[model samples]
Target: MYPKILICDDVVYSRTMLKNILDQIGQYIIVEVENGKELISELLKSRETGAEFSYLFLDLELRREDGISLLREVRKMEPLLKIFLSGGISLTDENIKKGIDLGVKGFVSKPYKSKHVKTIFKSV
Candidate 1:
């Protein structure tokens, strides 16, 4: 079965680009969200239907909210979920340390890299 991916990024262009690559891979169910707020809301709503996403692809900087907060909240709610951080924003060593501290599965710097993403999802 294909792995499911929930992609949360504020930028339309970025989301579209990521979608194209993931679609080509044909091994992932990519669900796109505009930001952390929307992602969290969808997650809560999905509980009624008992649906869950397998992988999370999140942007660091977002419109009106930050992905880190969502990450933190999700960790608190579902600690075992896999997460892949992606965006133009670069986390400092300190920030990376903090993310590692949070137990995030992976960190990906964007403008989307198809090969890297494919390699990554394959390994998982």
Candidate 2:
């Protein structure tokens, strides 16, 4: 199975920033989507091709859909998926708990930093 990286964020700049960081670290095939619908579509397409994401960088706040809801659906499909929440807003404890309950692996706050990215990769 080919390793994939999925990035779901409504903000173009956020996706670009993360992509740049990933590109700097290695040659990864990163995919980007602006909404939950697109995210689902991409996941399905990847699955059909016998591929799974090594990690998913999902934004908590999308333009039209909540990421957590999508996360629930995705968890059912890829139970072992590595998911990281991202957003400009600080996640409350309750929300963080909710994410954990839904099987998210971690959170990546906005204004991306090298250290945060490094930590996530190190775990892998």
Candidate 3:
């Protein structure tokens, strides 16, 4: 199935940033959220509507809550969804361990490269 991507970041610019990259993918339907709260809410709503979430680009830090908290909840509710974490969380062993436990697909940075986004979309 063609994946529907969700971008969740507290920073307005960061959300716009990935939205631009995901738009270039042509096939995947991209959705945007401002924080973990909105992300979880949308996930729940989408679940009710039978719209599957395929990819999620989540920022680790948020004013209201952390994406890891949302990640944990997503695993419980939507285990099949693939997640990508960016900004405020390093790709460290501990973080990778946590993300892998929930089946994260990949990651991008705050200042993501266009070429890398192109490559990743092609590969996925």
Candidate 4:
């Protein structure tokens, strides 16, 4: 089966851009969520159905939820999941370190670029 790639971003434009970039790389089932609650719900549903996403690109500044908190919960449930973070704000070294501490595989700064997308895919 084609691998599923999950994208959790609050911005519609960002999600579309990411989906388009990933589509250029390979065939993948790209799942999208606009908030933390949907992110959790989708992950749980996927796990139960044996359709867990192969990669997750999460926005650092999700609406109404702390990304770090959400990441912690996701790590608890899916320790092996490959996760990456993205944000409009420039990623500080501290923020990157925090994500790394939480088991993030990589980070992609917005707006999405072919090179950044390619790098994350390769790293994962």
The top-ranked prediction according to lDDT is: 4
Better candidate number, 1 or 4, judged by lDDT: 4
Clashes of 4: 0
Q: Give the TM-score of candidate 1.
A: 0.87
lDDT tens string, model 3, 45-82? Answer: 88998987877788876678866777898778888777
Write down the TM-score of every candidate: 0.87, 0.91, 0.85, 0.95
**Pairs that collide, model 4:** none
Q: lDDT of each model, Cα atoms only?
A: 0.77, 0.84, 0.76, 0.89
1 or 3: which has the higher TM-score?
1
Query: Could you give me the TM-score of model 3 versus the true structure?
Result: 0.85
lDDT of 3 at 114: 75
On a 0 to 1 TM-score scale, where does candidate 4 land against the true structure?
Answer: 0.95
lDDT of 1 by residue, 59-109 (tens): 878878766777798788667778877766556676577678888777777
Q: Which stretches of candidate 4 lie over 4 Å from their true place?
A: none
Of 3 and 4, the candidate ranking higher by TM-score = 4
For this target, which candidate reaches the highest TM-score against the unseen true structure?
Answer: 4
- Residues 48-120, candidate 2: write the lDDT tens digits: 9877677899888887887778888888988888898887674777778889898788777788887898687
Residue pairs in clash, model 1: none
Candidate 4 lDDT over 42-110, as tens digits, reads: 999999999888889999888788888888888898899999989867377888998999889888889
Q: What ranking emerges by lDDT with the best candidate at the front?
A: 4, 2, 1, 3
